[model samples]
Target: MTVLSDTSIKKAVLSGELSILPFHDDALQPASYDMRLYWKILISPMRHENGRTVDLRKEPNHTFFVEPGRFVGILTEEKISLPLSMVGRFGLRSEFTRHGLVAFGGIQIDPGFKGRLAISLFHAGPELIPLKLGRKMFTVEFNQLADQASKGYDGPFQNQSTFHKMQKDFILNAHTTSLAEINTLPSEIASIQHRLTMHETFYHPKREFPSISELAKAQGVSPINDITELSGLLSEEDDIDTFLETVQKWRRGNNNDE
Candidate 1:
């Protein structure tokens, strides 16, 4: 299969083998055609803005803001129809890619497809991007298949002239969280953990808890395992661990009858 040049593309259009409605000469390239942004609208869910929809039929604003991290869907100004012998490749212009515009859609137009393209896009730049109506944003490159496919394109999206229901739902229920805020969650969690463990260690860090072994070393070399010795040492010992060890020594000696 070979890609169609601008001259060949026009011939195919003139012959009714390919279709590009409302076509403009300036939009044609060496081997592709640029599709302009439709004036219908761009919907972004904004906690700051009062509403979620952008019905241009009522509103006078012709431009939409793609804030950092918000996902939005847009339509092309032209409708396309491809014959069974022709297929197409699709993507956004490189100029928009440099500004951190990520375009999302199927890259291939199946043979004999007829539809207006609806593209999902996100602005990932540090600042917000304002997109005006009729702006050139997408490109479609037509190519001729070696032979006509045995079958023609007949998918759920075929003859799609407007946004799909799924696309509408996405805009209707978009989350307000920005990607920038999501990135800092790990550090925020780490800070909370450190706060819970702040300050000097409780009691002593030498051992998990004070034991009879620690007491034995503090008072004398060997344990005082006699009851009479324990009663006298307990009266003098002020520390909790020392007092516990004094009682333990007497209990061990009595149990073993030593």
Candidate 2:
């Protein structure tokens, strides 16, 4: 498979061959853009005899809380009709990962697979990164397959329109269970840990807590709400840390105390 070049990315967007998400304030670069999660998601209430139990279409008003500094998988509303002769898969934008966010699934593309995309996102940072609805999180980069493979992902998730959590079998495995015993596990696990810790040190710094009343007034919202509620379920220590840093930066009071 050949990766899509920057020019190809632009051409695809212009030709409607690829869907371009809403541009966020932080999404200008020479290469790729970002995408955001929808407000609601469908969660399975219980496991039934077969995997065909819960359907997202059946539930309309279902809500899933997307806490700041966390991850969620969402389905894009747009659909792609790939010609049978061509095949492609999505690639995660590296900038998002640098910002302590995840945008990759299994990184697999099936031949003859035609449908919308399901994006998986995870934030390993401490600070709350606010995301607005319809904002871009990552751009889709397509690769051309030399020859279309026999198997494609056409069964369950095709033409999916809503965000739903993956099945239980998807996450739990030898990787999740016994780590030390696996021969190849130590280096891979260590590498992931190293990257995560490094990201926390650099990008996910603590933030200062804004005064709830002040924040409410500034945002032109209600003041009676809990400060935490207004803060979107993010860790409070991050805010406090930011506040402390800002205070230290401007500790020299010129005329206020006089």
Q: Rate the local accuracy (lDDT) of all candidates.
A: 0.79, 0.50
Output the worst ten-in-a-row residue range by lDDT, candidate 1: 50-59
lDDT of 2 by residue, 43-145 (tens): 2121221212223343333323323333444555445554343455555555556656566475554555555567655555444444434445445545666
Q: Over the stretch 79-187, how does candidate 1's per-residue lDDT look in tens digits?
A: 9999989999999899888888898778899998888888777778767676777888889999899998888889877898888887767765665666666788899
- Those runs of model 1 whose alpha carbons end farther than 4 Å from true positions after fitting are 48-51, 56-61, 179-258
Top model number, lDDT: 1
On TM-score, the leading prediction is 1
Model 2: CA > 4 A from native: 6-71, 149-152, 164-258
| Cα-based TM-score, every candidate | 0.66, 0.42
Model 2, position 21, has a per-residue lDDT of: 45
